[model samples]
Target: MKNTIAERILDFLKGFPPFDSLTHEQLLIISKQVKVSYFEKDSVVFGQQEALHDCFYVVKDGAIGIYRDHTLVDQCDEGDIFGLRAIIRKDQYLLNAIATEESIVYGIPAKLIEEVLNTNIKANRFIIASFATNTRNPYSDEDKGTLFANETVLQPNASSFTEVQSASFSKNPITCIPNTTIQDASLIMSSSKVGSIIIAEDNKPLGIITDKDLRNKIATGKHQITEHVEAIMSTPVITFPDTITVAEAQIAMLKHEISHLCITKDGTIHSELVGILSEHDIIVIHGNNPSVLIKEVKRASSAEQLKQIREKAQGLLQNYIEQHIPITFISNIISAINDAITKRCITLSIEELKQEPPTSFAWLAIGSQGRKEQLLLTDQDNALVYENVTDDTNTKSYFLKLSEAVNHKLSIVGFELCPAKMMASNPKWCLSVSEWKSQFKTWITHPDTDKIMLCTIFFDYDHVYGNHDLVDEMSDSIFDAIDSYEIFLNFLGKNALTNPPPLSFFRNFLVEDSGDHKDQFDIKARAMMPLVDAARLLILSHEIKDINNTIARYNKLSELEPQNSDLYNSCIQAFRILLRFRTQHGIKNNTSGRYIDIDSLSKSDRLKLKGCFKPIKDIQELVRVRFMLSQMM
Candidate 1:
């Protein structure tokens, strides 16, 4: 009897690891015996001290949280495996595995994993590496040599350190000429057992056709198989020099979102094509550097490819956090990757429109991204400002369409759509420079509760892609409006004080009273936001521009006000610690990092967090005194 579900399981398992190391026959056999389980949100699969189940679990959908003493220790999302530690140890579970969201999971029998561990060295090493990374007691000498007694555990290479290695490519690349019939090219590809075939003239690459092109064009009947390959092939192919490193190659593929890159002698279209590099080749090289990811984003041809790369970046981020890399460094690198992806999406959208913009436009990243504190994938908050035009209808239409495309792509790449529809794709947010100026004026002058909220989100705008002059003009306009309505800063100050300090008089955390995160501390709203609000208000009052980052703003403030330098420095330190803490929590629980489980934190961590609150309290008082917000409050 045929089992369709088993086949699907095999397909999914093949894409992820320890399973990826297994043979097809082994996977098929294991998949057939796999048990599928469903779990509701907050439902526990196993509790700490319970006897280990007969099998380990792999997440098929949604997420599972591994908790120690009711505190989340790790989160297992799609394709992630958990519970193996307990199985390997043959002991009571040390952590509780609970569904963080409604989920489907596959349970692979312990016997199968044991067999794989004994038979496959790579599978064993991967499991060991995963345990080393995930386990809280990884450095415990008793567990180190015990798991892999005979086999040595090879740690995964640091991504940044792997960038300089030379890249490997397919030397005997399959090729055709411009005049080759699509059918002939297809036959050649089939005969050669290749997914792509390059079209060249004088041994210089002209275009390329891949399996995607065939599926999208020939299979869809958009183009006939009898047509010349040139009619369907993707032209002006991305070419890289043979001297490119593994990191460079990987980045190239990601940047263009293309699966294949043409390797040429001189790294130019004018040079002779020598070889071909595919995404598969880069994956095989195992270089997961940020530079490589940025390149991948640049070469990404579709949103889906960018999405895969972004997911890979999450893993990289987790590794960095675990390694205790500087939080500022991590933030800067991730922000650069995010900015690059946004820019590439914009570039791709323009190509899709097949026309130049009628006027200069600037894409503004607002909120966390604007402040350059985005360390994890979060909702996109952006707006667009274009040059004023006499007949604005056509220009607006063009930009709206462009924004729609860019926003959709950004969403696909892991940035969630703004729940409030604060994206540029929204017509209200996408406006000409003049309209944007007028809108800012209204919000500043009016300064109502809603308007102040909007001001907090929008005022920290950073130019992501497009005309800097336009963004500069927009900034200038904001200062001009604030100058006219000086009292607006008081309203901003009042809003900043709304959250108050995160700690009570007894130094207890202020947890949520109600909602999904009732018992959890709202880190963003209570801790991070107060600092963010203070920075924006203070910076704006000084009429500073081009300094959207919270840390940078505080640093600038410290420099400008030597008398208040201590408070500003304290604010900076608090903001940095909180930012890192939030990022680690997000990574641990696969969450937004807005809510923190107080039970999960160690005493030292709690003390550190508590210490940060004093700065928040001091900052609020300073704002009150500076802006005279007592009456407003």
Candidate 2:
């Protein structure tokens, strides 16, 4: 006789993880030994310090809350495994597992799992990875995802790996008046080849009808075929703006457990319907690759065209951030797009000049843009360095004219000119190589507050276009000057410690007391800049000129100082979190994302920001002791 219960369990197990890694016959055999248990909400499945059970548990239904000292750390939904970490190590449970909702759990016997782990290499790696994650960081477990694989890309709920852009939806949404018969709506859906149709009044969505509604209402005879759509439709249809992201649309669908989202002008039903976002639309996105955008930028005939491509890159970035792509990967992609745009701007400006330069020159992007960590469109900060010329007058004039044209084009393409006049067009900034070296000497040796600030901004110079040799010489000059006056590094370190991660005495975020963003948190100056400054100062001390990105600098620092690796690694995480926050806030508020409203932040965001404060505090302390800033203080 077939064990019907075992077969049912086998079917469910085959759809999910490690069990899925095992052969069908092996899974069926294991399923026969599975012990199903039920628990009530608020009841403990396993208590902290309890001896390990004969089997570890998998969540079959509802939610299980993992807690340490009664503080909820993680919530495991259906198909999530718990209690395995302790069982793998043959230790007592370190964290309590309690049911958050009435739950059904399956207990897979430890001996059987061990037998599978011993026999199947594929299943062994899969199960061991989950075990490794749980042992390393119980709080994260990398969320029990596969090592080095992008889960977001693999899942149907999100788009492809590189497809981090705004979601594309059908602008010509199929629709009908609310009073239209269900039969008419069905016919409209069929003719339109759409699964859903909006019930609208004057272009505003009142409700929606999908094929599922037709099957459940009409096929089940729950509602008559001639009844009005309002009687069979899903009322208060979910909505988003046309700018919704692929991941966001996927999440909304998953969260609401619906197939369609009504896209509105202002992202609400009260506004005019602009389009409809269906799951099919996101699943079919071929992905917006950065290389494609770069090729388009290279071919762009006008700054306006480049600007449009750049805006598309912003959508890509939004999707990346939403999908939790590695910050370093996102940085590389965005920087490439930005670099391509900058190169195109220069090319157009050069063509407009209709004359070649007097000598070899290098365009330098200073500060954030130079660092290649710029994720959002911001004001341009740049300079120019040309080889020493006997004809000083024409050389300076030619480069200045070129710079002016380039700056204007960049501005038109959405990079606003620096309000501080820190651009290549400025005569002070567009200097010969010798002049640039002299300028670096002046800033480094003088060591005044203003000079130090300028040094901080200009020291991270990167060759954006033209001669690389000129930029290399500039780097040599800065390092040579730093070697002569080591105190400058101390001063730089002192500057790095200026803002200590914006926290009040009571552990609340320190907010702006005045100005336009009164009561808002300055995420850039308070959180991001501290890490950026620390990385720069540390890298300069090591004479590492090539690495400018904060994340990359921290990675290098980790390699250089293994004892301090933990601190540097933490700084990388903190900086990435803060940078992502700034980008998100900027996109949402249409500002630079420097100042964020504390009231608007979710509890998770507030905690993430708070987590960054620790590394900021530690790095500052390291700077103080290493530089002896304590005496200066």
Candidate 3:
């Protein structure tokens, strides 16, 4: 064991629990003796009724689920301590500790804990309290204060979380008399601060007029305001009962493409109008509307404001998936918000630079940002592509300065700079079109692991700002390079299959066996990315470009390979469901939805997850045959 790694692990542990109360020398001594262990999915660290080891474990990475009688009682993520209960009680383990995914953990000797307790009063009190809080009173602690806390521990009915939460409603709706003119309807709507007006007949909703109707019909001179409310109103309006949830309302509006839905006593025109549900009301609750969020992004001048807006967008994403809004639409809206954020970053960077960019350059968002499926806030993957500058030795320095500014501003706007320094500020990543072409040629021809990693990152580039022509030219060069080096696709195929779908005999999910996340599956690597990588490889083979989004690629594949349209369509559907599952898990845990504890999932959710695996297995089979990877496997 590296002393540095052991010291680092001790440093983390000393900040928390019983370890915190121990003397520095004592803690460091225990840390040095700690046994570092790793686990694959489903592997048991310690089973119920089994004698405890000399050491109790602390999760260093991933999760460890504690199960009693096959029911998960608690889950310990990063820095969470487990396995001490058995030692404390002087009995065999009452619950099983299983790795929730491939994870790293440190086993600190229980003897050291005893030594600290015997010598230090403070350490003893802390140890007793940790045991009381975590083991004896598990429910009253972590469960009560955290949002979505119910999801962390295993339970029944896990999948039945509200599909659409009840959105708060406006009790009073704007109304107009049947005889009211279109002009008057407009005035009432404006004064009432509403986007729609309900045309009521005998106190019952007869029709509705929205801003769109006035703009599309009256403003275009298709109709005059002098026309009565009935002339312009859309009769037999869509209505729902007051109990309609934000999810349902969003779906209704998107399905109809209308701005308003009447809320009546019985959800129909025959019933009395009780309230109004307008698109604005839904947008307020929906949280993720790109149009509304972009407006917020435009007005945001500070990092704090952008953070709040970004948080709201996360909720919006949750609602979008729950409502079954097509993934394509979801990706588009998210992409718009992401672009708006990047644009704001650019503006902020320029201000901080105290000067404008020296030359025209396109800001390219690579990887998930480029694919537009980035619902989660992750490290920024961006590059800069400037117009070729000739005869000026000073041009390189100017562009470099500009990239530094842009990268810094983007970091402030919530995109953490890539740790590998793949951002535009890295001169190697920020290249002119001709330079990028040569770089692509080198990577394609070489196709080593390092080059492949770069190819993966750069392949997903989507222009966030500046010249579209330059981006198109770069893409054209990429395809040309691929066409000339056919073996490069095989290299990609091998890389795609590197992490095979995590399924075992009888099609059960293969989770990590030991370490911190024992018995948990990595949904991202084992499921989602296989599909994503496969889609990328197949699309590249078809010589298709500019389609980075996974779902879009599948949609395009459906059109291109009519012979395999069924499988392609199935892939799209499966991808959508899996993406949603991963996003929900991520949101609930406040972490990337890569590692998933199988015990926490309800039977139905497990089945639903299993259903997604079918298509994955089928698709991988397709990839294997198409690429002749059977022998390679």
| TM-score top scorer | 2
In lDDT terms, which candidate is top? 1
State every prediction's TM-score relative to the real structure: 0.57, 0.61, 0.58
Worst 10 residues of 1 by lDDT: 145-154
lDDT of 1 by residue, 200-233 (tens): 9999999999987898799999999989999999
- In the order shown, the candidates' Cα RMSDs to the true structure are 25.5, 18.5, 29.1
Across residues 205-308, which tens digit of lDDT does each residue of candidate 3 receive? 98998876887789999889898988889987898997776546655654465657888898888889899886446434524334446666876787667777
Lowest summed lDDT window (length 10), candidate 3: 154-163
Stretches of candidate 3 exceeding 4 Å from the true structure: 1-167, 170-239, 242-289, 391-393, 514-516, 631-633
Q: What tens-digit string does per-residue lDDT give for candidate 2 at 1-633?
A: 999999999999887777777898999989999999999999999997687799988889998877766645556777877887666555566578999899999999988867987898766655543332222221234322322223342221222222245677898999999889988889999988888899999999999988768877899999997999999889899999886765466556644657789999999899999999875565333224454456568768898988888887887788777767777677767887888888888888889899988799999889998888788889999999999989999999999999999999889889999999999999999999999999999899889889989988998777889999999998999999999998899888888888876787899888888989899888888888888898999999999988888888999999999999999999988888888878878878777889887888789988988988999889988888998998887
Q: What is the lDDT of residue 366 in candidate 3?
A: 90
* C-alpha lDDT of candidate 3 relative to the true structure: 0.75
Ranking by TM-score: 2, 3, 1
How many clashes (backbone N, Cα, C below 3 Å) per candidate? 17, 1, 18
| Residue 403 in model 1: lDDT | 98
Model 1: number of clashes?
A: 17
